[model samples]
Target: MKDAKLSNVFAYQNITHKDVFLSQKKYLSLFLNTIMNLESLKQLFLYHGCDKIYVKILSANDNSKNQVYLSGSYDVLNIFPISEIVADSSGDWKKERFKASVKFSWITDEGKITDAPNSQFILYPKYPEVRFSGFLQKSHNAPSELMSKRLPGRLLFMSVSNSGKILGYVSSPESEVTQSFNSLKHLEVAGVFKVLELELKINYRELLLKELFRIHSLGWITSKRLHKSGNILPCVSSNCGGYTLEAELGISANGYSEPDYLGYEIKQFKANSFDRIANEVITLMTPEPTGGIYVDKGVGNFIKSYGYEDKSGKEDRLNIGGIHKSGVRQPLTGLTLQLIGFDTETFKIRNASGSISLIDGNGNEASSWSFTSLIKHWNKKHNQACYVPSKSVKVPLQKYLYGNKVLLGNGTDFQLFLKQMLLGNIYYDPGIKMEFVSSSKPVIKRRSQFRIKSGNLTNLYKQSEIVDLLKI
Candidate 1:
């Protein structure tokens, strides 16, 4: 007798047609009808140790009237059992069959392991015959039904069986289907999916171009409108053009878990404008220093020693700003921003004399981060960032309206940024602003700013990916 356990076939050699001996004419006919499909036949062959098999349907009345089907060398088919017989019909020993849901597993040419559930099939005890039944037709519209259940990746194939029950359903995975399902789920929870499938499929440069086209389609958006309701406007920010391209690209207004649009940060500014970036300076994030002379001195003592009088009429403020070139003294604090632990002439960072360290009001030393740490943080926040340039036109009744023409910056070079900072193309402009109330002690606010020329932005980034907004 053939091995009853289907899994055992994988260990043995090929089995012939005679090996699949079935009894009873009704059972034989049912088995033949079910294995008519290639999928079902492939499953049967895989389980029966047959590289090549010929299935013959024998009639109980006449063996000469039997039919046959052949399956060629079967290395491409992969079949695996999912479940065992759960329950069976009551005590009728003469007629009984076991049912199971099967699963298919295969490794793609790309080496990706894909496993999916197949439909139900029956195993008869009287014979080595198994009947494959297609999935029940839950609905006539396959896409609509699968979409409703958020299983868009599942491809369902349905047909009416001889008994009129819907037969056959197979699910195939497509990246687009998965993306659509994820997008739909995001929309349901967050009320929006920031990027469409087309947007996600393209490269970062193409995505930026698409966003520029979308912005241009808006025609002219006024600065006043953009500033007053900047969150809703297509422009960046009223003060500096913050949300322009990002808003146009349908990104969430607030900073959250992910990047602005399709894993890329969108930064927009006017073309040829001196002050393109909204913030005058960029802050490099770092952990607080644990132990040092500065830490022992504390914030109050450090300020007392290095603090300079402010021209704004405040009692005393330690304001550090302006361009501090390598080996040159800063105008205000007479200190230079230097790279530590490396040679300045050859490396991006170098240590300098009289480097000032900061301490918070809570007496904790504010640690300075290395260029590597800063670059890592920046790249994490913006794996890909697009810098867009726009043209502004003045209007009589309305505020300035931006033109459709826009330029895009492809990618950023963190090493180049560090080099620029060392070369004085970027400057450290730290400041402290004090606010006083009726009877309360003055509120001291500190800020760390690294300023750079708006025109020098191109030097900090790689080649541009320019796309005409008017032409899309």
Candidate 2:
């Protein structure tokens, strides 16, 4: 009768005697809370037209603990056709009340409604006081090692809040789980609200790392951004500062130097690898994150799309160079190698000079420069690879060879030059199948292209070419 549109009715079904009866007590309390209050009371009675209504009793351990839970079905019976119940002077109210009479019955041992209770109240509509109990559990915890990234392993816990918020969390050397069954075991004797894992103040970063370390057995990645002032924050750089490996959260390998990484100084780390440095920077900073680190997928794609000289109608912008031992020259302009998906092929020599090349199965070429006579004479004495091919194909003996071309160069090699191109490293399992198309062409087709999407360097957790490391 309150507001038909806003009000909802609940009905009970699945009345099985086998089910535990104690669970229904909570539902009964919730319903009373909604509809029982004196300020909103309304009631009416009838004698003749009311049909029979039935109530069932279930067995509890003791009669004092007994109760019947009412749902929306009771609302329909208690407050329908409100006009019939209002005590107006008009005779229509009296006539309507008489029309609403109903017979009452109770279920007995034989499961039949044998009789009704003797007393029944006939009255004007009014509400009653609603009383209920059993609120949820809320707790919090605090961690001391939040500022320092030095956890031995992962931890997990479960927590509940006074406002009925329940959270299951994991704290690892990376991320942690807090306030669950496992965490509860250690604090069983503590008061209802004082459990450590259930407490909410624990350092979530350490918690997550603890969980990650439990699973990975390695440390979580600790990347830091070096700001201008050089003050090391627990999180990554907020401004234009570059990223540095705070510590090897988990990854380890042979000969890998565990250098003390002071966060990125944009000036010192100008290499293209800075983009990945930014991504790991943001992931560690935000909690309950909405989005991810902004990356120029299109820029990488654009370079891949327009960057090379492809007979297949698409060019590879990032290419590897190949300089041959015989000193045969290839023109530098349209001569970039296809390195995007190559595995066995890698960059061996990225020299101090701007000229760059690849070392695939096909012989190498000084793919960025044009030949000069001084370079041709110089290559014979130095025992280096062939010189860069001339702009236009010319006599064989006059062609320039490597190591001498940079000595007589008129200007610095083009940063955007095809030879000084960036390289995209593609790593795969050792058994990955790959084949060279031809000596003249630098294309290696893999057995499957499915691995390409995930093989991008950005998706890679760590990257280093065999060329980047020192010989030691």
lDDT (CA) per prediction: 0.39, 0.21
Cα shift from native, residue 437, model 1 (Å): 10
TM-scores for the candidates? 0.43, 0.14
- The superposed Cα distance between candidate 1 and the true structure at residue 219, in angstroms, equals 5.1
Model 2 alpha-carbon drift over 4 Å, by segment: 1-333, 338-356, 359-364, 367-472
lDDT of 1 by residue, 326-357 (tens): 44655555554544433345532222111223
Q: Which candidate is the best by lDDT?
A: 1
Q: Name the candidate that leads on TM-score.
A: 1
lDDT of 1 at 457: 54
- Superposition error at 104 for model 1 (Å): 26
